[model samples]
Target: MARKPTSPADEVLLAAARARSSTVTATQLERWRGAGLLPRNVTRSLGRGRGSTSAPADGVVDLVVWLAQHARPGRRPHDLALHAFGEGLAVPEPTVRAAWRASVQRVVLSGERDLPAPADGEDRTDWAWDVAERAAANAASVVLPRRMRRIDERLAAAGVSWAPSELTQYDRGPAGEEPVTARDFATFAAAGVLAGAPELTGPAMAPHVRALLPVGAVSPVASWLEYPDEPGRDPAEINDGAGLSLLPIGDVREDLLRVIDEAEPHQLRAAWRAAAEMREWALEHCGAVEAELDAGELGDATLAWMMGAILGLPRLLVRQALLDRRPSISTQVSTAVMVLWIGVSLHRLRRLMPDGQYELLPALLPPFLHPLAGIPLKPVGEAAADDAVG
Candidate 1:
């Protein structure tokens, strides 16, 4: 049977979907469009007083057909955007923006823009401590999440205890001098800045470079940031070598919201790719560590993984989320934004160096991060091959 010339666009899409063996319906199409997951159709007028003809826009039929085929019962519009963007499909721009924005909205920071000045006859140092205490209130608590503690228990059961080393203090952290960790310092620094205290920047720098690069490389790279020295440090020495530009100069949260909201389609797609890559690398690296532990072997892998326990991906994810269910794509996208921010900041630090010939830095990292750093990770395969040779 021939269809009418002016059939509704949704019906046309449905027909295309049916051809592809998809279970799409008019209602589903309407809902997807409302959620910004699907693009709207185009309408054109016929000549000589004829009625108008409406049809799905270019690539719409194919996308709709895909949506019909792959749609999960509880899958969200943001998830669809992430999948579509990942697959190189032309997802609607608004959908990508809104979904990414929503992803970052989950993280919350509480503080006032202006802190009350020290009262008359108040000790200035006491006032600073009071302010710092309030800022530290939100710092990541020392009590490990249940999942992380379970992993720690497993490591302990295996007689795998980390030596108290300067390179990786996370195993027995909260170093005696300051209760402020890199993260707590960050919170205080941010609040202090907003409250008109730029001096906090020197001490508040986050050691994100160490997470991205090895300690040896991190030292030189940190110097490249041109970070101002703290009181006890030499002027040439950047306090912990973390640069101040990792985040923009305004409200960090608001800046992130704007960045996601205003990002172009290609930009969003790039972040999606990074997000997917980050997840893959994390899973692969963590799985490799677990495999080694199960096989009763101890080596560099365990050392690196344990050192990164708190600063790396959430323990809830490694021990719980994967077993429970996958994270929503929107959340993955949000995480990617943060990763990129660190990466770009690292690159910016490098650009500050006088002689930038350290291209081998990625290859120099701990084995776990090698894959993500673009070093082709094949230690497992190599080990198997070595056994064969032996």
Candidate 2:
């Protein structure tokens, strides 16, 4: 036989009424529950292994009951009551918790009445908005101009709807390239298309592009950016623009001597593809960098970054190479990170390339010359001084 349907009051109000001696009406119980003073689930279990069944103290239920009993109590400050509720429960649902918490807080914080001191000030909704605005502005400020359409499309494809002001704020920057927003960056990240974007293409680009997402692979462009080079130009001095120079500084028209300084040259075509592969490898396996840089592993510490750069360099080549066709086992994954591990470390110690030479110059060379452009592969002392030089 079918049992009669439980009354609406019985469904929600019965438990509260039973817990409170059934003195309060079901409606009243519901009102308290809606007000968030009542615990959603109250499990009643008999005491175990005892002579008499005594009402046991439940820490969780006691806290809940205490919170509701004092909630919005007459003569109590609104803010005080509100904070009390939060302190009582460890709730996970943010929206529900926040709404109820707000209601209790508002009552405690009402104008002109004093209560117990609050742990923290909570009245600044605008502060949150201000932070969001500034963050969007910073993101927009860095977007590359050439990538405007791509950024727009990526945002759209991701089904992200942003206000014009928000987009403008996020993309706001100098006239050239508009920097990608963090949100948009995350979107491109999810789609796995960050590596294929136009701004990340070519032999040279900014360091942040590679740094944005934790890609499975690195690009040749990234390799070129980190390339080490020959005489008078140290690798660090190239990308960061700081180095002592020995050339004659001058103007061509005048008879005056000119010391023209340049970024350390890295051979792009040759090193980029290989370096990218290493970059991808390192990223994929978190310990790849540490392993390559290990004193015992890849013992010649000078070769670390340069070799690591080779690992990811292929990623750059593959992106362009695969544009026309698909690669079955494209090394465009994290395995390339290893190459960059070697590349960056060696570059750091300024041991990967010929001293006094510009790293950036070699990076500008064609990819076909990759095998030949770099300094000799032999260890520092083993290779002839003149032959070891790039």
Candidate 3:
């Protein structure tokens, strides 16, 4: 059967209707009409002017919902162009804006924006899916925040009630206490897991760090030739040069290389010295990457994420120090840090997705790492190696 052509007035009206109910523009309506997505007679013509044409009420609602579902990110859709037509149903700007926001919330914001729907009846599939996804994500987000806050409060209370500076002096850690070392990279690595991370202490810290001490060297500062000038030291010179050359893992050493790379000559030398000790430590411990990864004691993802986090700090710090007119540090330190971190992240990501596909990383990470975790569409945490490598 042959379909009748839509009148100009109905087209104009449909444009307004779509705009009010969904977010479709008049231009999109015209395109849909031309594409047979809408019935030809769905539009109406009221007057002589170009603005007189409009779309039907039913078509307007349907098209708006369709556009919202398929709208691409980073590009404005054709439906937005309908704001040009001022006549039709006299929908208020604020009301339409609110309705649009609501529609987006119902469709996309709830995270059910990717479900399939049949072309015929029942428009509630996507809408219902969105509500369910949003509810689940919301519940998780709410519960996690409360748990985190309670833990934090309990720790703070314990710290205030039984404050002890050192473990040797204190009997036991407070109830539900987190390691203080995690708050600082050097401390965390040295005290928790890294070999050279713990000894970066006191006024001697800066000087010893500048000297590039060995990762496992006990009393590294005393091993330096410059120590002879200090108060209680004998005139005996030390020669543990090899000990200072090897960087320990988890130290902020590569960050020094970046600083030297980026810093002006005036600050370059000092920043290099500052990184000496850390560099030596990182070189030794972190160098054995393959072995550590194989053991699974070191998570590739966690290491990579931490590397990024650590490097970002130095980038900002160097700039801030330079702005203070202190050119004693290298500006390029952040780059080295970032590269190492990225390497770690990529290594982990590769392991997580052995097949060189994102079927795992994208689906798994958000649910596990994001505050608002969701029920994954696929079993992301399942052993991926069997599927990809096997």
Q: Pick the candidate with the highest TM-score.
A: 1
Consecutive 10-residue window with the lowest summed lDDT within model 3: 366-375
**Stretch of 10 with least lDDT, candidate 2:** 253-262
lDDT of each: 0.54, 0.33, 0.33
In Å, residue 316's CA in model 2 sits off its true spot by 8.9
For candidate 2, the lDDT comes to 0.33
CA RMSD, predictions in order: 8.4, 27.0, 24.7
Summarize candidate 2's per-residue lDDT along 51-140 as a digit string, tens digits.
332221234344344444554446233232334433434222333234323332332112113223233424222232233333334343
Q: In model 3, what lDDT does residue 245 have?
A: 22
Q: How many backbone clashes does candidate 3 have?
A: 44
Angstrom error at residue 61, model 1: 2.7
Per-model clash counts, in order, read 0, 99, 44
Which candidate number would show the highest lDDT if scored against the true structure? 1
TM-score between model 2 and native: 0.19
Regions of model 1 farther than 4 Å from truth: 1-11, 23-31, 42-58, 69-80, 105-176, 180-202, 205-246, 261-267, 303-326, 350-354, 364-390
The collision pairs in model 1 are none
In candidate 2, stretches whose alpha carbon ends up further than 4 angstroms from where it belongs are: 1-179, 182-285, 288-327, 330-356, 359-372, 379-390
lDDT of 1 by residue, 298-328 (tens): 6666665664542333332343223324666
| Model 3 ranges with Cα > 4 A deviation | 1-175, 179-185, 191-331, 348-390
